[model samples]
Target: MKTMIVIPARLASSRLSEKLLLRAAGKSILQHTYEAAKRAAITDSIIVAADDPRIVAEVDSFGGEARLTSVDCQSGTDRLAEIALMHSDVDLFVNVQGDEPEISPATIDAVARLLATRPDADIATAAFPILDESKLHDPACVKVVMGANDRAILFSRASVPHVRDGITPAHLQASPPIFWQHIGLYAYRRDFLLWFATQPAGRLEQLEKLEQLRAIEAGKTIVVTAIESSPPGIDTLEDFREFVARIENQ
Candidate 1:
């Protein structure tokens, strides 16, 4: 099964406009992400699914493959679906976020392999342990609950597995934790990718603003793999600056 990694990039970012074009460590963010995906062993090809011509040109300038997708694509998954439409030979599609310039190739390979092996699974994603107590409570940091066989039971912004016992919140924080942080990277089977494009957003999906919830609501299994670390994604100016500093230090 061939795995194709498609990075959905747009010039008009609400938080940081043209973030993919932003310079970090003397390389554009999109270029970094594309190169990182290329490093993954499981991927047969890496393509940029761009909604804007500027982003397309940027990818082309770096000698990277890019395709112009519909600007009407509401999300990354939607943009990837458009790319999938043109490439019928691809068996697996991996959605790599454009802001995740520091995304690990190992992490990408792990998720793609999981989907490739699990015939019953519709999607595969990655998660890492949330060591920070503050991040555990942060709604911006999505949480994922994994079940037997490493399948995701649910994903939400709210903290999961509420302590039923008389354990105080402070004490619970001090104790070893079972919570995990959700990573945005996703690998979907070709059939599921097409089905996902047609389905309407479910109630849970709308409430959580997570497109993955639609799959869960439809009884689709999502396998979650554990990763040691994930690099910080560029969402704000501070994040971009920190990424630059980290690259320079390296």
Candidate 2:
């Protein structure tokens, strides 16, 4: 199956404001993400599905391929749909969010591999065991409830599978793990993206502000690949600053 990586970059960001254009270690965040995606062994083809000419220009500056998508696209996956329409030859598309400059290439590979291996699955995503009690309660850290065979039952910002009695350190440190922090990285089949674009946003998706839930609510099978951990995405000025500090310190 032909696979490609698409980094959906919207120039306007609610938290950090044009954060993809923000530079760290002499590279724009979009470029950093693009380069990181390129490092993944899954596929060599990478495109930045940009919502603005500025983002296209930025990609051009890095000698990377980019296509201008409609600004009206609601989510990153929607932006990738636009690219999917253009590249019919590609069967699978991996979404590595432009904000995630520090995203792991292994995580990218894992998601792609999972989707490629599972014909029953419509989408494949990565998640890591959440060892921290604080992250379980923090809405910022999305939690995934897994059912069986690595299939995701649900994705929510709220703490789920509510320990009923209580959550203890043992629950957090369980062998199989009771809590998982969902990563934004995803590998979507071409047909899934096409069908997803035509469908209106699901109720659960809008309520949680998570695009993946739209598919979940629609009864699409989403498989999850367990990863060790994930690097932080740049969502705010503080996140960008911390990323810069880490890069500079490196």
Candidate with the greatest TM-score versus the true structure: 2
Q: Provide the clashing-pair count of each candidate structure.
A: 0, 0
Candidate 2: misplaced stretches above 4 Å?
A: none
What lDDT score belongs to each candidate, Candidate 1 first?
Answer: 0.89, 0.92
Model 1: runs farther than 4 Å from truth?
165-177
TM-scores of the candidates in the order shown: 0.95, 0.98
Q: Global CA lDDT of candidate 1, please?
A: 0.89
lDDT digits (tens) for residues 139-212 of candidate 2: 99999999989999999999987998999999999999889999988999999998998899899988999888
- lDDT per residue for candidate 1 within 1-250, as digits (tens), equals 9889999988888898788899977789999888988999998898999888998889989999999888688888998899898889999999999999889999999999999899989999999877766776789999998888999999999877555563355644543346788999999988889889988999999999989999999999999998867889999999999989998899
The global Cα lDDT (0 to 1) of model 2 is: 0.92
